[model samples]
Target: MFNLAAKPFDYLIVGAGFAGAVLAERLAAGSGKRVLLVDRRPHIGGNAYDYYNDAGILVHRYGPHIFHTNAERIWKYLSRFTTWRPYEHRVLANINSKLLPIPINLTTINTLYKLNLSSEGMQVFLAQRAEEPETIRTAKDVVLAAVGRDLYEKFFEGYTRKQWGVDPSKLDKSVTARIPTRTNTDDRYFGDTYQAMPKCGYTRLFENMLDHPNIKVMVNTDYREIVKSFRHDRLIYTGPVDEFFDYRFGRLPYRSLSFRHVTLDRPQFQPTAVVNYPSTDVPYTRITEYKYLTGQTHDQTSISYETPCDEGDPYYPVPNPENAVLYKKYETLAAKTPGVWFAGRLATYRYYNMDQVVAQSLALYSQLSELDGSLAQDERTKQSIVA
Candidate 1:
């Protein structure tokens, strides 16, 4: 048996993603504890990894991750690592051989329904166009209520069906309920107080954050193999809760994505950062031009087309009744497991943005520290009795 006493680490954190890195930083910096962060993948930034392509253009290797949040604390915390670059994410949808703004705005509805009406007229038209449902409960219900059956089937259904690998009709109300219909012509994707990307890039920002002397990172190392040997007072796990339990109850359902990153020998490919393809025939959800987000005026640019696939790394949790039930079982098991604390997207099984992850990790760190102090005091009392 590997001796746990041989290793010299205070905290063992799983998955060097946002949650692990942030927690490690807090424990090491705030509490002055030695920390070891491990990731199964041989990378630091996790899914938000960015690198320069052959064209010398900074590109999102996984997919586009635009940092936008309303949380002031999160913005202030992230500002310590890297300088912010102003980035407003705009989305275009290719429909009926024309590229148009999304969110089914006045222009979108007018072009889609072929109505030459003013903003007020568009609002009135949409009132008539909107489907009157008794109660909106499912994804279909929520979308159908905003834009009528015609627009719902045309814009949301096919795209969502391909993206989640489930019929929109079967999805929960919250799955697609956030999408809003606009009478005015506001084409911006998100409405957040802090909407910007790192000027240098996300990887560098993460690198700077995790580069502290008190923090130790082990990439391409599974926690299971090392946890038996490594000596740590506490654990901060950011990996899947199901994985932590070895999926004893059952695997919580998660949606995975496949990305096809390509390089184009031009300054730009599309006009905007992203173009949503809301059709099953397209085979891809959206195409993101990296130059738009990076603001790099290179001779050539890079783009990534997202194709929803079954087999890849788990990205998003499928928020359905069956998965919810399974997750509840995992939650119960996670609570029972002593010395292991869970946080982050996969562990919590929630759809979280970057800033949200950082904020959640910070909160988790505070709780973990308090728990550690209490446990240390209890252990010291027990040792005094023996002495």
Candidate 2:
């Protein structure tokens, strides 16, 4: 047996979230390398962590993480650990005392305008109102090109302002482009080929993934606390990129969220999984009912109210010209740093869905494996590596 105290660990993974957990499994089980996975939180699943509340209801601690993916390989990879429960996410936008399907679908438009129209008619109606932008450069531009100002104001403007702490016109097009407008009445939040959640919850899925003998886990301990004492050949960093470099190029802007969780003594609280409050009348951007996402039959329901703010744990990277330029500086610096690889949303300063994060970590592992010749060329890859 390999003694943990006698020799250096092969990989020291920071953050036991999706990026770190998936990569740690790949490195330890696939390559037979000793891995150390550490998280600042007292759990292994990171932000996707879920647990049973006082009422015995399963609730996501941070927010709802509904798994959806177009990549078949990714679905297959995660399926190895736990069985899945089919789940299709749906959202509603509360507008002017009306609850309508979001993504501005046909049902949403008809309900808002009180008109009966077919899919083709809906397309024509949108085309008649949408203004052709001279150049689509900003979030407001994208919104106006798809739907007119009236719809934009009702469904997007106030929410964007509250969520990002800025007007839509000042943000990057990628911000609004993430949300799709449908001509049809399909109200599903994501149109991926695979949509499901772990049968036992994300925490259990993570437990199965990190059960390898070669992988060790430490929680409630920041990497900085144990990094100096622990000897590791390579490092996988999944934290904020700016902090790693000590904000030398100045702090990159990020939007954080404040979540308020409550377990109500009722069978259900909302009609659907999530309801978006685009109006500025409310402080929160959205409210999520975990029972809908998890499909748990419980007398008491658990929900989370999300308030986006400038403070708290960074949840979203603010996308704009200035922030992009700042992130590039950190990226360049990371490339030069030896034996360290940055992965995940915060580390790369990009907003990625849970599936995308998993795909990225898998791709990174492949690159490392092929380039390092099964880690025989570890000394060389350590110096020139850029992930």
Report lDDT (CA) for all predictions. 0.85, 0.93
Off by over 4 Å in 2: 1-3, 374-387
lDDT of 1 by residue, 238-325 (tens): 8777877888988887788888988877777888999999888889999999889988888887888899887778888887788888
lDDT of 2 by residue, 1-387 (tens): 446797789899999999999999999989888999999888989789999988888999988899999999999999999999999999999999899999889999999999998999999999989977899999999999999999999999999999999999999999999899999999999999999999999999999999998998999989998998889989999999999999998998989889999988889898999999999999999999998988899888989999999988888899999899999999999999999999999999988999999999999999878856855667667777863
Report the CA-based lDDT of candidate 1 relative to the real structure. 0.85
Stretches of candidate 1 above 4 Å error? 1-7, 373-387
What is the TM-score (0 to 1) of candidate 1? 0.93
Give me the candidate number with maximum lDDT: 2
How far is each candidate from the true structure, as Cα RMSD in Å? 2.9, 3.8
lDDT of 2: 0.93
Q: For each candidate, what TM-score against the reference?
A: 0.93, 0.96
